[model samples]
Target: MPFSHAFHPATDHTRLGKLFYDAVEPASFPAHILRYRNNRAAATVGMDTLTDEEWIDHFGRFTPLPGSLPHPLALRYHGHQFRQYNPDLGDGRGFLFAQLRDDKGRLLDLGTKGSGRTPWSRGGDGRLTLKGGVREILAASMLEALGVETSRALSLIETGENLERHDEPSPTRSAVLVRLSHSHIRIGTFQRLAANAETDAIGQLVAYVLETYYPQLGVPAEGEAALTLFKAVCQNVARVGAQWMAAGFVHGVLNTDNIAITGESFDYGPWRFLPRFDQNFTAAYFDQTGLYSYGRQPGALLWNLARLAECLLEFCSHEALTGALSDFPELYETALDAAWCRRLGVMQENPEADRAFRHAVTLFMETSGIPFHCLPFDWYGGGISAQRALASDRAHFYNDPSFSDARKALEARRPLPGLSLDHPYFAGGVPCNMLITTVEDLWTSLNDRNDWQALDRKLAEIDLMADALGTRESLSD
Candidate 1:
């Protein structure tokens, strides 16, 4: 099979002695049952060549792949966990396994979770619960279908180990999850360099990022590259934050370390889709202060962007960095409008129409008193026809007076080109959603009967939704 090694021997992160990562090996597990495999993502990188056994060996047993990273690299970094800065945080449970390019030739990283222990394990056992792996698969699938730029859970394997945890049942099952994403670099990656005052290393990292990911930016003047990279990252982060809002996703933990440099969402832990339009909705149980609530996702991401700007300050002037950081709010609002329009399944008419439509949608959601997920389902083809929505369970809510102006705004636009009003999803009265109860119910069947048919069915439904509405990349255009 033809494979492009985008980040291995072709381009190593050349900040030698900066301690950006550490070499680690995966744990030997008793079982290597392939629980899930993403052939859609695999085919993009020519990894579909791997047979089922090869997939298990490579991802489950952690056997080194030919021409891939010879040793797993446990990346080092620091993050502000729950608003408190912690210097001793890094990839304790996983490492980068390989770097390959997708069919579009975009660089992609194959990273692991619950694979094994690393230097950053910090006395805790570096393991992942089987239930955790299952939840991530569902989260990624649902997010992708909803047009959120997110990592795909490429492969999941039951590792056949009993793990004890404070959260879930003790001596529970164990598994390893591998995800495909654009990049594993994080805001915390730059924070470590800034903390060490490693100006030279920071410059080198900036150059690497530009050449590897943002080549379109081209080479800038000597001292200007860092600022340029910071600005681009800020824009990308803002765009992703906007998508999260449009998707009704509360990312639970918005730590700097969880913020992907490529602006793709990954590392799902306690994420939740909103039941309704509540701004205070939070997913993490430990979040006593509601720091990273549903409405605060944008602010949390901006905070992370500021940390990245602080890192660039070592190489660029403070004024330049702040200028880049200041662009986030406006950039986020613009991106949010675009994303919301895409989710609404309509072409953005103009700046005024776009702004008005977005506001109308928000107002409708705030006052509708319906489950948040219903809007996307009932209006699958852009809410162009209120008659169709009225036929379903949403009829009473759609009749509410507050939705009058919102329905008018949607009626002004035609259906998004190429979307069929007759898609089967539109006819299905119940919209597909990954609510907490639904996810737990799916797991319950698995736990009781060791049956995975329901999980498989949910994925099929999600794929159909993605095809009907289009992925994030397709809709944005």
Candidate 2:
């Protein structure tokens, strides 16, 4: 690889000793068949020079890349799983494999899932099903296309193994997956240190987070560092929650361990795109209580931020911590307005007007029975093309009187400057969404006949949509 040494695997965790992580090795597999690779994400890290063989060796066989970690580290952390504090929680099937800098000079981590078992493996095998890998690829791709900050699956390898599972069919295929993200440090990391009353360790971790992940925050005055970090984290988490809500995404599980410190969405286990504007839509079959439902996501995230604040109480005054927590709702509302405006393809000139237009759009979608994901696909590029949207097969029920006010309000807002109303994405009628049924159908084609045409086409379509919307580019430009 051209930038092999672009990786600098330094284990600061070793300084924290066995309290934060366990040394582990990857599981040996029968075969290493490449199933997927994300070249776009690779380009960001200058890893595009890796040959197919080397990619397999480093990512599939789990060999430590040169100048990277000598051994995998299974991070230790206790988290609130489904609101129940579980002290035994940590990385069981996954471990931090390597660390590298990206094109922007930001540090990134390469983490593995289904690598093998560590001390935290509890009772189950530390492996991932092939279907799970496929689902994650789709979820990450779609989320990225929708302009959400999310972890990308760098590589997925079908490790030759016949795995038996209860949720999925018995004797399903197995796989190993590698993910690339800004940071793997989670909210639960602080929770664990706080739980052990390791105030010094928490302070050290806080400094590390500032330097490595939240560098823009700079070094705060000594006494106020923890409070400043908490406020910044709260704002980021609020922004993420807003993004998920605006995108109509349900994360399935909102465990503290699943909440990354950098606020990037990852660990897509049972995620789902909304089929309608139902507030109670849940992705996980076991979430019968609707705890992490679509409407409750913002609430769940705010709750997690409060927990993170609790972890910082020892370093900061109680008043400061509570003050930071108090900002979540307002920050989330502001973030939601901005996110909704971006999705609707309009200029956010007036905050009141933006809010009114967004509310009207929501009412229209709810009354017209349109799927929430259709908002961007239909209104993308900034103008309401009711006729064009109505032409789509999915828009058969979009003729309700409730849309009158929304349509008029939408007409009043200007399209984002320079974006064509007739962009290819908008012209295509409806945008593609990875709803559960669609995902299952794509997987069925692969599992039944080893066909990948549908998946390939869908990815291409998503890429085109991203280009049309300038998803990765600055919207202000």
Candidate 3:
């Protein structure tokens, strides 16, 4: 009841009509134990002041937020799973619970994962393992700190239930996760409309997206609107793809349904950070072919964008769509340059110099066998960190012949002005890394001893890293 003045709630998605989603009820859990609550994210939507009891009533029991959605909506969508078209795919375990404007006036959705089964629940129980919830929190936190546009794990509550899962040890603890993201619309949302030949619905969806998310484009003439939206989404997908690469993140599942139409990364399932710069690194155990491997992520994004472009064919010219799709490589390259510069804490030079420097760094990362995070961590602030890098425990890795070109390239670039290299985080022997081993260890402590201290400590370290990199505040800006 203590909503802040900044609170602005809207049920905009409902305007799309019953055809877009099915209103559903949340499952009644036996118990509600608050596991994690992101006050920083909750503050954005003016719900930070809520007591833990109120938080449970709202997020856990699905008691509707005032002036927001009355009940959850299981959104309908279709997507390609590993290049195979699956018409049955939709929000089986999750639903859009609420929509409200953040402090910056951007629309944010409070979506639930593992709240309960929906109409799309194909047969399996729609529950999420507690371990799965923890993994998502870790992935989202780390990606945000690394400057990736990602969803925030707003609330994670351990529901009093034991669920059986084949992937993990059976009879795992159950939890429901609330993710805060800019939009829940996915590329597959369009795909579903197109597949059904619902051209009128597609037009309405395009109008809604442009008006709500891409207002900068304004109301273009009907003929040009679809193409303009396609172009903008293309640019967004390209930039996010490049950001993922620079962050050394492998999203594991790059399915079209998992890709947000707003370009923000959400649905952190089976995601992993690179331990080393191996192109073949993959996150999912079931990803036997590595279709969504680290190196293939950009191509996967482009492929999904093309699928989106196909959905617009009924409204836009084929030639124009193809031309827009072709621009991804260049847009991605430009974005990568900017992302790498930001991560390394350097000012970008001329395009040629930036390209050469990136190439040199890539060559060294691939051949020198140094840990992927070390490159940016050691060379952060560019030439200014030379002494600090040289004295680090991993200095011998940098002395390898393969690193000479990258070392020279880094020294030639200037650090961004006003970077606070004196931060205590940088004084450590190594940077904050979220390797698989580290994640598993954190989970082990929690699953065995119910000890949250390890996870809490890691979150603190991630916050410190974000502060040092200036990513946390910059993302809100």
Candidate 4:
């Protein structure tokens, strides 16, 4: 295969040594049927030219990428699952398959889901239901289009296996998913080292993360390096949490393992986009207490970051680490305000004005019982689209007396410079949404009749939405 000039392979993770992960083999599948390929993501790493056969071989068969990891590595880590510390947690059914640099020379990892069993499998079948894979693809696509910092679902291939899952009907189809992410090193990675009292390993991991992910910070004094990295990670994670809030997403699981040190959202299990503004809404059926609910995500993330800080305590003082953690609320508030402005396509004013606007928008949405997507879709350009929005079918909801504050807020802000409202996506009757019902229907069409039209059409609509939102352009920057 001809790898493009932009394709730069690196085995940087290996530098962390065997103590952080274990070499593993991918399971040999009965069949390799390609389901989805993220050509855009592939293009970033210069693999978009691969034929279907080659794509299947590399992603499904787990063939090593040229100049990348020769074999898979099931990473070692421990995480707090729903506030309960679980020492046995790790990559139970996934592995870091390959690592390479994108066009901008940033490291990226090709990680697998349901590729095989490993020491962490714990007697469970190391397989992903086809329905689960479909959900993840949709989740990633929708989140990315909405300008959320998330992993890209690189490739999904049916693996011709019958799997029994409690969550779904028996004898369901199986698949393997490959996701492209900035990094797979999780807070749990550091937790594992801390748990074992491997202070030296923790220091090594801290140095590796700084050099690989935060090189801009440069070499800090030995005492300040860990604190510096913690602060950066805090900022990144806070931005992610704020983005989720702006997108009205509920990540059902906020486990330490799922919270990547890089702050990129990945491992979409039981995720949901809000149909309406409901703070108590949760995606996972198992979340009885709503620990990671839509309204509480910011707090949940801060809690997880504290866990990461605990691991870094060996290198930094408690007061310094706590102060770094203290920055999360302000950082999240700032990011959330900016994210809302971006989504609304309005120019941001002072912090007080921005905060008031956001609060007004939230108050109206919660009290009016309007669909979550409708508000942003209707008022995308703020006051600039007021006439268009009021003329639409959803205008009745906007006319309510409760909308007065939000209306005033919108009228006070100007549309972002060069933000055109003429995009066909805005003119459409309905906005692109990923409600649970829509997802289930899409899956049903594919599973019962092998009809991919609905799924394909939805993806195309999502792309149009992205174009209108300028999320694709923002991501490129």
Residue 387, candidate 3: Cα error in Å is 0.4
lDDT of each: 0.83, 0.83, 0.91, 0.92
Better of 2 and 3 by TM-score: 3
191-254 in candidate 1: lDDT tens per residue?
8888888777778788888888898898898878988888888888898889889889999999
Please give the range of 10 consecutive residues that has the lowest summed lDDT in model 3. Answer: 397-406
- After superposition, candidate 4 runs with Cα above 4 Å error: none
Q: Which ten residues in a row have the lowest lDDT in candidate 1?
A: 2-11
C-alpha-based local distance difference test score of model 4: 0.92
Cα lDDT of model 4 by residue, 183-246, tens digit: 9999999999999999999999999999999888999985899999999999999998988988
List pairs with backbone clashes in candidate 3.
none
Please list the residue runs of candidate 3 whose C-alpha ends up more than 4 Å from where it truly belongs after superposition: none
Question: What value does the lDDT take at residue 462 in candidate 4?
Answer: 95
Error of 4 at 267 (Å): 0.7
Write the number of the candidate with greater lDDT, choosing between 1 and 3. 3
Q: In order, how many clashes per candidate?
A: 0, 0, 0, 0
RMSD of each: 2.1, 2.0, 0.9, 0.9
Error of 3 at 81 (Å): 0.3
